[model samples]
Target: MKKRDILFFSAAFVLALLFGCGNGSSQHSFALGDSTFMLDNKPYQIISGEIHYPRVPREAWRARMKMAKAMGLNTIGTYVFWNLHEPEKGKFDFSGNNDIAAFVKIAKEEGLWVILRPSPYVCAEWEFGGYPYWLQNEKGLEVRSREEKYLSEYKKYINEVGKQLAPLQVNHGGNIIMVQVENEYGSYGADKVYLEMNRKMFVDAGFDGLLYTCDPEKDIVKGHLAGLMPAINGQDNPAKVKQAVRNLNEGKGPFFIAEWYPAWFDWWGTPHHKVPASQYTGKLDTVLQAGISINMYMFHGGSTRGFMNGANFRDTIPFEPQISSYDYDAPLDEAGNATDKFMKFRAVIARHLPKGEKLPDVPAAKPSMALNAITFDKEIGIFDYVGPGKVNENPLTFEDMNQAYGYMIYQTKVTGGAKTELKINGLRDYGIVFIDGVRKGILDRRLGQESMMLKVPAGTHSLEIFVENMGRINFGPNLLKNKKGIVGEVTFGGKVLKSWTMFSLPFDKVETSKIKETKSAKQTPVLKLASFEVAKPLDTYLDFRKWGKGVVWVNGHNLGKYWSIGPQQTVYLPAEWLKKGKNEIVILELNKPEINQLSSLEQPILDQMSDNK
Candidate 1:
């Protein structure tokens, strides 16, 4: 009887051990401060690189993850761009490039952890800082605040994103270990309630991983929560790092540099920002020596592609628009080539790792090419092609003209007497007005100047005005606004003119291709045709440094706005977008007439000589 009782007791003990050890709770629940970022208590150090899902194409997700891992990064930090995921109210996109769940699953397959920063407002210098344009349309919607309307929409976004990622958190056998609250909130505002609301939403949505806030050292005090970890962003000073922890936690347990800037981004008409490789390498070494962890702001800053780069405010200026190419002068260039900064940083990291630990080999650089001369002829003025539609008596704004993006041309015949005082009433941003064949006046948005006076020939003369929609303002007081073309009246001798014929040039690829030649006295004098051939498709930058100013296209894909301005000379051309054998290139130079020939260089167009010089 004793032997049988012993056998029964042993079986019961074994069953209990198996069920308890294999329960779901064991796999979920990440514990920081413990080694391995322990689920049920283990040690973990998250080595992550920041990558935005919308910035990188879906086809390249796995490849990019592989690159991150190869760089000795065990985790991938991705920010969920609200505008891309939910461009319209109540509508969401989790497919293709917007498929964040697929991206997380693929990261797991690649043996990488995830740090999710699902900021409904991600100020990655992205258009509207990742906020949807429709949010701006809402009358008086306050961003990054506790405003009811804004919070309501933000909660909806968090829920939708959580549905895709909450189940994949480390607690759920997936690799996501931490979910970030509103990105850099303290720098924008001191809405602790809004930040807490965001945190609660993620927790309620089932994201049980560690919750944290990222901001500069000064912001740590205001931005961080008492219970959660505080991660600093863009802080390289050691004292600042220590202070960030002290300010947030009176000396906290886990401290990380969420974003360490390796380089800066270039804006149109501004000088290219190039931080020395030595400075970046030294900063990284200092942080690592102090045993502080950091994530390179962008291990690889990819192309902005299309109209995605955001704009900022400058005192009195309406907006300071960023160039489309977000090259960022990063460790990895826009085309994904490892720069000198990459090598220096890698060597620095390799030196600091534990003994016998070696950094992975750097990936091979992709190939690039320069195209021969390509030319485009402007056979007619854009206004001459207007069809049967009745001409509006007054000029229309870009939106009123039903043009969402690109350039528009307004032309009128002046029948009144010539006057020295000519004023453009409501010029939105910039305009180049020409009276007959002579340049009359220039209006710029930055100065808030909307008119210019020019000597005019009396009685039936051509008045041509060309206006471009500068990238929309993405932040600050005027965010909900749209500015394009001439907004008001054209006045000559204190009297406003009427009956203007407008030409809308949104530059749709199809529409541009169908443009036909037309003869008009106002038509451009030179008709240029240029062609180039490439043996294989490679990422090539058309040197805009040659032309004064213009827009360019490679095989129907618009490369975005290029100007002969000082700072941005190079436009990025992705290899995936280029085609083999005879890729067509087109350019519409604004100020240049006789200098028609165009050629591509091996380097970036921004690298080309400044047109102003």
Candidate 2:
């Protein structure tokens, strides 16, 4: 063993004598005491790590929880994404990865306590911040506020969530001990009524365990409820953490660090965020020594998976969308493998374990394979399959047209005119401008471009703009303004363009298998196909360094979007999504990539920068 391991074992032996073994008797009872949480009437400290069920593959939930336990954590914390469960409003999906009950049961099976944050708004780096996209279509809906429509929808959603997970709470013969109310209301608004509404909603829906609220140190008093525990986020300094907790609980007991950031999340253009273990272990040691409960924000950050990864924007930071990977550079990496940080933290956690308790041996990393390069010479043009569209005086936003995600095409006839400036009032995210079927230029929302000069010959011509909904703004006051597609009118030569036909191409709805392969790629976007054979399938990372910007589908499973802009160069392709025989890979290449081939990598290249960036 290394010197660190020897030191950890010695410390563990000493602490074991001080703190007693496990939650004493198994007859479960958890409640908020004057200053500490009482489990079976005895003080209990929650040692938890965060992981989202939807983010990790359903196949790996048990493994991830087991790993959490081995890391010396006794509890698991997770956020239930609202948009994922009810993707289409009335429709609800609790099956597969969205199965909250099963996820909780698995945590119980792994001997881990649970904390649920099922929400109307989670503000996770997720699409629309966990609010269903369809909610925007509802008239007078204002989220994170007391707007009747929003609250009404919020009630229904949370109640449904209660039905799925409420029965699993500790009071109901399960391991779930605490449930959070409204993610971080203090940073958003100071509406005490709205905060109270969220509290009642959780209770009314059946979460009877200790209900707590979490916020940044500044917002603790403002964001927390009168009766519930006020847990602080981000602040790791032991003294400040205790002070903030005291300020909220009126100098009472049961202080918790709801979200301790060991590392940070990555954005599309930013460097992969990482925090050195040495940087935080000292503060962690102090906090643990003080007997304060802490939950690391992400013990394991699985892949963001689909187009569901979110973006960040404001009046200042125009557009900085998140990458597909939600690696977070955490103790458990994106691939669910333990890192050096994992061991260092595990050693620290071992020192704090209950008396006569020892951390489990770290789980072995899963197998991975590097495959031969794949060629996708066969192609089908995206423009070839422009479906029937809705015609209106002006273009309708994705929400207005009753469509949620993916691309939109707004086409209109532009009358011949002299050199004039063509402008779009609300050109959202990104767009590719085309006149008479030839690519004119690009209108990128990230670049803050809304207008481009247009000079046309003397004849009526088609003006089409292909708009891609990069992602919705997930954080800050600007979330309300995040409607995908063109929200306003398009104009030419100072005159409003008229009678536009807009098509909603969600891509998932598009029948790519039906489209026949073509010899020549079109001027517009192309759908490239790669069919390869695998003798034995294993977990792999699909290299997207050569591809420009597009979504990839492997054997009908959408692996999400990838941009040439750096920081993430590959997409994680788990073996579960692969087949033993021939497998198909479909890519909707927006901008033509220089390479029409794809490769499988044994290791992920998450930190590589795109030269273009």
CA lDDT scores, all candidates in order:
0.70, 0.84
Clashing pairs in 2: 34-253, 35-253, 35-254, 36-254
State the lDDT of candidate 1 residue by residue for 134-177, as single tens digits. Answer: 67545667777778888888888888998999988876677788
State TM-scores per candidate: 0.82, 0.94
Task: Give the distance in Å from residue 328's predicted Cα in candidate 2 to where it truly belongs.
Answer: 0.7
Query: For model 2, how big is the CA root-mean-square deviation?
Result: 7.8
What stretches of model 2 exceed 4 Å from their correct place?
A: 1-26
